[model samples]
Target: MIPYEEIKVPVAGGELAAVRWPAGDPDAPVVVALHGITANALSWGPVARLLAGRVTLVAPDLRGRAGSSGLPGPYGIAAHADDIAALTEALGLDRVVLAGHSMGAFVAVVAAVRHPERFGPLLLVDGGIGFPAPTHLSPDELMTAVIGPAMDRLSMTFADRAAYRAFWQAHPAFAGAWSDEVDAYIQRDLTGGEPAMHSTCRIEAVRTDGIGLFDEEVLSAVRKLPVEATLLWAARGLMDEEQGLYDEKRLAAADLDGTRLEPVAVRDVNHYTVLTGDRGGREIADRLVAYARA
Candidate 1:
């Protein structure tokens, strides 16, 4: 079975809950893995398995998501990066290898730039590079066009865990890719009583963090990345769309006149299953292991 300890890292006025998946040896290297805006710490489980003997992965339930959902946030990308910086400092970690998925990548970018000394090479999964700045679009518009049905889940109430899993089962990304890990991940997303279950992620936080992605902090960090980083994009988009969130054209365009951002494409996975799928998660974990050894 996958092994981990749920711990609360002190942040802001309170504490931030995290999934601490240990490495085989006590002396094994460490990496701080951040999940997507609406996701929780457990979302890192699949990938953690592959890095089990090589790296200790600490995945945080960023403020306003899951266990940290109730934390009062002056929420935004800035707050997230600050929280991460605080988490790293509180843990007494040095030369942190910060890996962030989706919106978490954007938060990592801000954190790397905000606290350059503390961060080592970054593994930015599917974000922090592609964007239309907030100056170009409203957060509401960004949310509707980008997150789409995912935002609808905030208002949706599932009658039971199976019902909630049913909702995710219908999602195109998972189509035939669902497994016990995915089931557990989706089931944990539910809250309230058996008769009425809702997502633990606060919609306001999603809205704020979603818009925060387009903010200057992210854009500025992109223009001047503080350290070496890798961008691993999923071949498919959020809805299993033909077009992924970032295509080769946008990636190429992003490269010219900007800091060098290494990019890799993971075939056949969408944003949601990038880490949930075995192939993609193993690939990401292998790279992370290599990063630790380097």
Candidate 2:
């Protein structure tokens, strides 16, 4: 397995942890990958492995997931975008190819617009476009509507890592795509030991960010996006159904500045496996490498 360097970035509440995977070339370009709302930096492991020795890839734990979960509130897409901006600034990167999966993709768009000078091109995976909100719903209702199963899993506790694996093993998304990397992602998310093996993602963090997922802030950012961005969405929905997250017709209808946004549909896989499975992960890694080189 490829290794990574852990870093702590100072933000408003506390420190945000980041992981840097060396791409084996001193002159290689830098690429920063962001995880989904409930995922951590390790969510990019499969992608990192595929791109090893190609470019220096970095993944931040964001504000409230895994190693950085303990950081205080003031969480949201805008806050997370600022954290990314602060992180890139602290690392002294004038510009980086920013790639974000799921909610992270939304964060990338906001960051790109807010700090255009910090990024070159954007690689969005399974997110950033479909702000499909059922009108006038509460935050809880919004979370249930947008990310039901994923949102529900946050509060559920498992007996052990084995059980946790079993829960996901039965998930339709990983039907035939489960791998050691996925096991690592699952294991890393488990905290509180055996008796109370709970997800490390903070509940409050999820609540705060869940509300932002359907907010106009992200949509506004996408509308005003100034740089080139490409979205790669899966063929299946979050529950591994035939329908996917971003509807083609809906996305096509949205007034996403054509000059700034491009959407690519990825065949096979669902929300979870899009970046954690072998084929989808490599596809994303390849795109990220291409983005870095361009």
Candidate 1, after superposition: displacement of residue 276 in Å?
Answer: 0.8
Candidate 1 lDDT over 1-294, as tens digits, reads 397888888888688888888888988888999988777887788998877668999989899888788788789998999999988898888878999998889888889989998888899888878565555656687788768888888988888988888888999999999888788777667789978889999888899888777666677687677788888999889888878988889887676355756888998889978888888899889888888778
| Pairs in clash, predicted candidate 1 | none
Query: What's the TM for model 1?
Result: 0.96
lDDT of candidate model 2 versus the reference: 0.86
Worst ten in a row by lDDT for model 2: 250-259
- What's each prediction's TM-score? 0.96, 0.95
Output the lDDT of residue 64, model 1. Answer: 87
Best by lDDT: 2
Residue range 1-294, candidate 2, lDDT tens digits: 478899898888788898888878888999999999888888899999999679998899988888888888888998999999989988888778999999999999999998999888899999887555777887788888877888888889899889999998998888888888788777777899777789989988888887887678787777777788888889888888988887677676776655588888888778888899877888898888888887
